[model samples]
Target: MLQHPKYIVRRLQPADAPSFYAAVRESVDELTYWMPWCSKDYSLSDAEAWMQSTSDMWAAGAEFPLGIFDATTGEVLGGTGVNHINRAYRIGNIGYWVSSKRTGQGIARFAAHESAVLGFGELGLTRLEIVVLTHNRASQRVAETVGAKLECEARNRLYFQGSPHSAFVYSLVPEDVR
Candidate 1:
């Protein structure tokens, strides 16, 4: 677990499903535009399945999907992960989102930076990427605030909502964080 003064970042557990469900339901409207998995039809069962899948992937060393939570109350604040790993090159992609109610509160930024620390310090990653949709200015800000350098706007870098979209690709190396 990664402890922060404002929050904690840790692997998801089955017991977290209820909070995850509530968070997703609250944020689905905002999340739907950027996250393909979140929708009006999202259910608690989906959250449970997500927790399970994340756990399975972690066990397999395939991915690390984690939760951002309140340090005092354990309420779900957001989610972040180090995914799309290149183990041979020690690189990974960092993705994150905050609950709608917590937008503009720096939770996403905090969770993202801590996730980078996790990637570099424990996951042994030398490089991490923050790929955000070109239109997502909020996410872009989070990447920049976390000290990731804007490498370029790559063409067709992401597929979202059944279409290809260009993305701002940011690079975060060990030095970028420390």
Candidate 2:
């Protein structure tokens, strides 16, 4: 588990299902726009399945999806991860999202930076990428705030919700952090 001054970043547990579902449900409108898997029809069963998938991925060292929680109250805040790993190249993707009500509170920025630290320090990744859909200004800002250099705008970099998207690709190296 990783700790921040006001939050904790850790692996999901079975008990987190209820809170996870609530978080997703509360942010479904915003989340569905970018995260295709989360739709208006998202249910508690979906959260359970997601946790199971994340557990399997963690065991395989394929992807690491962690939940961010309030340090004091243990409330589910959001999620961040070092996923889409290319182990041979020591490269991975760092991504994060926060509750809509918590946006503009620097939570996403912390999650972004911490995830990069996890990528470099724990995952031993030499390079990390933050790919934000071109239209996602808030996420782009978080990537920039964490010192992930804007590399380029890549066409068709992501296929989500059954469509191709142009994305702003950012890169972060170990030196990018203190």
Candidate 3:
């Protein structure tokens, strides 16, 4: 787990389903815009299943999905993680999202940075990537804040609700974080 003055970052647990569900429910509209898995019908069961899947992935060393929480209140802030891990290449992709109310608070930036630290420091990863939808300026800003370089733009790189979207690919190496 990673701790910061304003928030705590950690792996998801089954017990977190309720709060996670609530957070998603509150921001479903905004989240559905970019998150393929998010929808108006998302349920607590889905959150629990997601938590279970994340746990399994962690055990298999395939991916890490972390939850960000309010440091003091323990409220679910959002999530960030290193996914699509490619062990052979020592590379992983970083992704993050915050509740609508938490936007503009720097929470996403902090969580993203911490995820990079975990990826490069603990996971022995050599490179990290952040893919942002072309229209997602907020996410692009987070990648920039963490020193990720704009690598290129790809067409139909991200899929949301079964449709492809163009995205800007940003990359960060260990030295970029340092």
Candidate 4:
């Protein structure tokens, strides 16, 4: 777990289903624009299933799904994690989303930075990548703030919702964080 003055970042748990559901519901409209999995009909069952999958992935050492929470009140702020793990290659993908109410507060960047530290220091990953839609300036800014370099742009590199979207790929190494 990573603690900050404003928020705490930690692994997802089964007990977080309700709060997670609520947060996602509140942010659904904004999230749907960038997150393929988000939609108007997202339900509590989906949140529960996602939490379960996260636990399973963690146990299998395949992915690390984390939650960002308010430090004092413990309200769910958003989600961030090092996923798409490639253990043999020592690489992982970083992804994050903040509740619309929480955007512009640097929460995504801070949580992403902490996720990178965990990826490099605890997970022994050598490289972490953050792929942002070409139109997603906010996410690109977060990547830059976390010291990820723009490596390239790939055609239809991301599969969102159902269709493929091109993205600007950014990467970071341990030295970049240090």
Q: Highest TM-score among the candidates is held by which one?
A: 1
lDDT of 1 by residue, 113-172 (tens): 888998998899999999999999999999999999999999999999998989999999
Off by over 4 Å in 1: none
CA lDDT, candidate 1, residue 137: 94
Worst 10 residues of 3 by lDDT: 157-166
Of the two candidates 1 and 3, the one with more favorable lDDT, higher being better, is 1
Per-residue lDDT, model 1, residue 54, is 95
**Ordering by lDDT:** 1, 4, 3, 2
The lDDT of each candidate is 0.93, 0.89, 0.92, 0.92
Model 2 stretches astray by more than 4 angstroms: none
Query: For model 1, what is the alpha-carbon lDDT of residue 139?
Result: 95
Question: Candidate 1 vs candidate 3: which has greater TM-score?
Answer: 1
Tell me the TM-score of each prediction against the true structure.
0.97, 0.96, 0.95, 0.96
In candidate 4, the residue pairs with backbone N, CA or C atoms under 3 Å apart (3 or more residues apart, or in different chains) clash, namely 36-161
RMSD of each: 0.9, 1.1, 1.2, 1.1
Put down candidate 3 lDDT per residue, 61-170, tens digits, no spaces. 88989999999988888999999988999999999999998899999999999899999998999999999989989999999998999989999998856788889999
Poorest lDDT segment (10 consecutive residues) of candidate 1? 1-10
Model 2 agreement with the true structure over 117-147: per-residue lDDT tens digits: 8899989999999999998899999999999
lDDT per residue (tens digit) for residues 1-178 in model 4: 6688999999888998898998999999998877878888999999999999989989998889899999998888899999998888999999999998889999999999989999999999999999999999999999999999999999999987678889999999999995
